[model samples]
Target: MKVIAINGSPRKDWNTATMLRHALQGSADRGAFTELIHLYELDYRGCSSCFACKTLGSPSYGRCAQQDDLAPVLRRIEEAGALILGSPIYFGQVTGEMRSFLERLLFPYLRYSREKRSLFPRKMDTAWIYTMNCPEAAIKDAGYDRVFAENERLLKMIFGGSCFTLTSHETLQFADYGKVDADMFDPAGRKARHEQVFPRDCERAYELGARLAQNISRGLPS
Candidate 1:
């Protein structure tokens, strides 16, 4: 069995990547082949808005017809038992690349006919992890709850799978507080929160991964 973690952060070694790695490591510990795909390392674009996948009797049904770096990754996801998508919130939503990836990944599976169902029939479990500088109390300030809920709904609808979500709030923003302008953020507060909560978040991510693998192995919802 395979489980893939897609990291949509520009900084491969940043908090977002670290959290994803922890999750992947957990999947690995559970005996699933785990791989990490970093979007910043790839050259790709969002969906092209082509109707090829939607064309009647199209061979590309349920698959992205676009020729890009993400195509193969999509195939891998289609074959995998579990998926973990991690991103640092950018301007109140997932980063542009992550959003673009989602557009390509999900749009093709949408069917318009009566009894519409995703063309991809495989059962896969998914987890979405989001990291942000804002505290949990401010999560609604950006209105991400709606977005997260919608995406979770779509993942289940399209893949006939279960989905889980993790959010790491008040993430560490700056590595060196002394060199940067500290007026805009409370470095001390961030430090305290990070020291107290980030590790626990990582543990949760690890548990999520292991549980997803276990559930997928048993052909059950995660």
Candidate 2:
């Protein structure tokens, strides 16, 4: 089984990256081949809304027509058994990198794999990772939940599979120079969230990967 993680945070090795690293680590421990693609290192653009992909008899499935960094990433996503996307909340929404990458991902699914195949590919699963300064108890109070929920809704409509969200509170405070405290920080801030939220939100990603590996091995589940 192959698990692909797209870390969309510009701060590639920070809060969001750290969490996804653990999540992907879990996938690795489960015997799944895993990779983390940091968006900051890639060169790509958001969907340009070109209809060229929808032209009749297109040969490219799961590929964006735009010749940029996204094409290679899309190929990896299609080949992977599981997907875990991580983003840092910026101004109550995902970062520009994440948003743009999301557009690239959605455009294909929205267009029905460029008329070549279905978006979900029969048994693939996706998970979303969010790390922000907002505390868990105050997620709704911060009003970011609405924005994220809307994004999730759109994702579900487009992908049609189990999607999970993992959010971290006081993420900014978690680090000094990109290194979180070893211990003895304010427990009230994000302790409950950290302890309670192990990999529950990302378990589906692994399960989905395993299920997908099984399905692909069984020839697309009939």
lDDT winner: 1
RMSD after CA superposition, every candidate: 1.3, 5.3
Cα lDDT listed for each candidate: 0.88, 0.69
lDDT of 2 by residue, 1-222 (tens): 687888888777677777777777666665778889999998888988775555566764445688887788887787776677888888888889889998888766665535534454654556777877666788888898888788777666665655666676665445343265446555554545444553453454345445534443454431
Q: Which segments of model 1 are wrong by more than 4 Å?
A: none
**Which 10 consecutive residues of model 2 have the lowest summed lDDT?**
213-222
Instruction: List the candidate 2 regions with Cα displacement exceeding 4 Å.
Output: 112-120, 173-222
